[model samples]
Target: MFENLSERLERSFKILKGQGSITELNVAETLKDVRRALLDADVNYNVAKRFTDDVKKKAIGRNVLTAVKPNELMVKIVRDELAELMGGTAAEFKIDGNPAVILMSGLQGSGKTTFSAKLANLLKSKNGKKPMMVACDVYRPAAIEQLKVLANQLGVPVYSEEGSKDPVSIAKHAINEAKNQGCDVVIVDTAGRLAIDEEMMTEIAAIKKAINPTETLFVVDSMTGQDAVNTAKEFNERLDFDGVVLTKLDGDTRGGAALSIRKVVDKPIKFVGTGEKVDALDLFHPDRMADRILGMGDIISLVERAQQQYDEEEAKKLEAKIAKNQFDFNDFLSQIQQVKRMGNLKDLVSMIPGVGKMVKDMDISDDAFKGIEAIIYSMTPEERKHPSLLDGRRRKRLAMGSGTSIQEVNRLITQFDQIRKVMKQLQGGKAAKMAKMASRLRRR
Candidate 1:
């Protein structure tokens, strides 16, 4: 998401590379470039200046450790500053009260409704909360239906007044319904305007007052850049939102909103919507985000996602197969589906340390495993279990069935063999322990 900024920051750090030590003159040029990089990334002008100034202040006149390179030190300094700028740490959230109320507020098209459901999903599955989504977006046609669709996807109940136009009344009634239904949390999706206006603000304010939510979240579209920051500023002044939710972060190249909104509103970014999937929502961890912004990757988040997808009984069975050299196309297809569920392919790849930049320009699709999956699906059950069963004629038939060339089919088999060999080795060491741990994740 911060692709451009990562590249620019890498260049900025290079300004200090090969230098004898940290000095005023050398640090000046680096901080200047850093400030420029922040500005280019759509960071607020004052925030950019202050960030570099702070980094320069801490950096200048500091003695470089013999073990660390000047450039590496500068990178760490900037990474810390970046994290501090983005709220320093993840914010705390509350879902208290009989049916803990959460009011959703935002400008139109800020993904307020979508994030509402995402938040509910996270609470339901991750936090073990019985969340009921309330469709209070009365101004927008079918907005209630939209929330209902997402709520259904999560298997959560939805509350709405079919003919009522008063959002405040609707929201209040929903909370009462939630209590009656034994729902622990009530998420009220309030109406938003095309732009911030008096009427829109007043309506949400009245709703918030009537409901007296445990938390009020202002969702901002990260793709909007500076506009997102300005909108957040206005909302914070009026609503005093408990936290900010940055949506569309995966699609944004210049993440100005994420970088500036926390500082502008003096509110923590509690969550981030990394993709369109309801499960794409992540608890905003400032340190992990700073790691990403500096091209350091986010191994912690990557591992967490993997842990989420690893199935216990399945893992035990897969481990046994790997040991027996029985890892086949079926297992491979299963693995691919699990990986796909972790999140976007490019976003997942970007989490590997030092790999984000190399793939910055490449188009990494979510369907990266489509061809392999097609080839595997074309194989018969017996053929899939035994690779050697595929003779020259069988391979040709498989290629035709899969709509792939003979060469592609041969390539897949060859790669599969190599992967099978690697899996056998991986089952013998720390990798095996990691797999065991990951598989036992849900139980934890």
Candidate 2:
């Protein structure tokens, strides 16, 4: 996400690499480079200056222990300072009311509507809450329809009053509807203008007054750089928003808004939009983000995603099948599906330490398993259950059905067989313990 900033920060740490201990002169040199990196990332002049100053002070104050290298100590100091700058810990949304009302505020095209749907989907799936999206963007009927379509896809109800010009009324009515429907959360998607104006502020203020929302989130596009921070300040002045939502973090953002917004508006970033998908919303964590900026992969978030998608009962059943030598094409297909459920493939793979930097330039599509899934889907029920029964003739038939060649099918079968062997070794206990140890290291 902040690949450029990460590269710059890593180079800044190299100033202390050959030094045996940290001195004021060396720390100043390193902090100067770090300051430049933050500026290059579009961080505010004052914020970046204070950040590096704090980092320098921390580095100089630490004892020069024998076990820690000077460079390692400096990196630690920088990481802590960065975390503190971004808000030391994660701040969750207040969804405690009977029908918790979350009002989305931002300029047009800042992804307010999309984020509303994503938040609803997240609460429904993760928090086990029945959320109803309220479409109050009456100026654009298409926007309301978009919210409705997204809500339908998520299997969540959407409340909207067509042809209603009064957004406040629509919001109030939607909240009542949510209460009637037994919804635990109501996400109101309000209308936004191209820029901040009195009218826009007035409309939002009225909606807030009418609803007395439990949470008001100001959504800003991270790609706007310094403008995002400025807009956030303007919004907070009028709305006094509960938290910030930085959208389009998946884009080539220069890390400006993320680094400066919290400092500028004095509000914690509650959520980040990593992608356009409804499942792309992530809770903001300052420490984890600092690790990402320092080119250290966020393995904790990766494992949490895995745990969310990993079905323990299903895994135990698959282990039993592997031990019985009954793991077949169907089981392999199921495993692929489970991995896909963990979110984007490239995002997941990049969380592994060293893997992200190694393959940063490679094209890892979200559908990395398209070919494998197609091949598996082409197989009949009997073929999926009994992969050993497939001969040369059967392989050719399967290849043609899946729009692939015989060699491709053969390669998949070979990989699946190897996976099954690994599963068997894991079930035998020796390999499983080693795998667990490796996972723990990656998480660190």
Candidate 3:
């Protein structure tokens, strides 16, 4: 997402490398490089200047710990500043309203409608709330349909009056519908409009007034860089949004918007859309994001993702199975499914410390597990349950069925045996717990 910025920041930090402490000369040169990196990342000129200046003021003459290197100390300083620059901590919103209204505002193509559905799904599945999506984008018929499709997929209700041109009226009726349906959360997906369009802005402003949303979020495209920041400012000046929702952060974005929007609009980034999938939404965490930008990785977020898919009872079952050497193809397939549910494979890999830099250039696809899944699926149910029953003849038949070579089938079986051995050895240790977590994030 911030690949270029991350690399540049890494290079900037290297200026302190081999130094015993943070001195004026070394810190100045490093700050210069850091400033240039921020500029190249499309950060606002004033924001970049203030950030580097603030960083310099805090960095130079700092008492470095005996065990910490100059570069490490500098990294800690910059990471803390970066976190503070982006909202010091995660912001909280009122989701407890009898029917909480969340108004979505942004320009077309910023993925606002899509994010609304994503947020609805997140609230529905994770927060135990009945979220009903209200399509108030009256100008765009397709937008309504899109929300409906996503709502249907999520099994959430959608309130829309087809062919109605009055969005404010639709919004009011939607709230009433929410009350009638006993829905606790009503996310109103408003029409996307330009910041310069006074009429459009006025329309949305009226809708916001009518609904009195508990949280009015301005959805922005992170790839738009400084433009996103400016648009956010314009919207905030008009509607005074409660927070920001950054969409398409998983794309090839320079990350200027994320770093600058909060400073410019004085609002917290509440959520971020990582991928196109409804499940790809994440609560924005500034410290974790700063860690990711500095190439240090976000192990906490990694563990959290793994934890979401980690089943205590299932893990216990597998632990018992591994202890008894009863791990089989069926267990392997189930583990693969858990990892797949964790979201993008490359994004998942990037969360591991040190692994992100190594595989930054590797084209790790979400389909990385397809071959392995196919091979397992080709196996007979009995063979999956009792993998030991797979003789040479069975392996050959399975390879043909899976459109793979016999060598691949043999290799998979060998790898599975090795994993069983490793799991057995790591049992009853902290390494085993981490191994189980990593295993849950593995693609295949």
Best by lDDT: 3
**What order do you get sorting by TM-score, best first?**
2, 3, 1
Give lDDT for model 1. 0.89
Query: Ten-residue segment with the worst summed lDDT in candidate 3?
Result: 435-444
RMSD to the hidden true structure, all candidates:
1.8, 2.5, 3.0
lDDT, candidate 2, residue 57? 68
Better of 2 and 3 by lDDT: 3
RMSD of 1: 1.8
lDDT of each: 0.89, 0.88, 0.90
| Residue 154 in model 3: lDDT | 95
Off by over 4 Å in 1: 436-444
- Candidate 2 residue spans exceeding 4 A from truth: 430-444
User: On TM-score, who's better, 1 or 2?
Assistant: 2
The lDDT-based order of candidates, best leading, equals 3, 1, 2
**Candidate 2 similarity to native, TM-score:** 0.96
Q: Model 3: per-residue lDDT, tens digit, 408-427?
A: 99999999889888877877
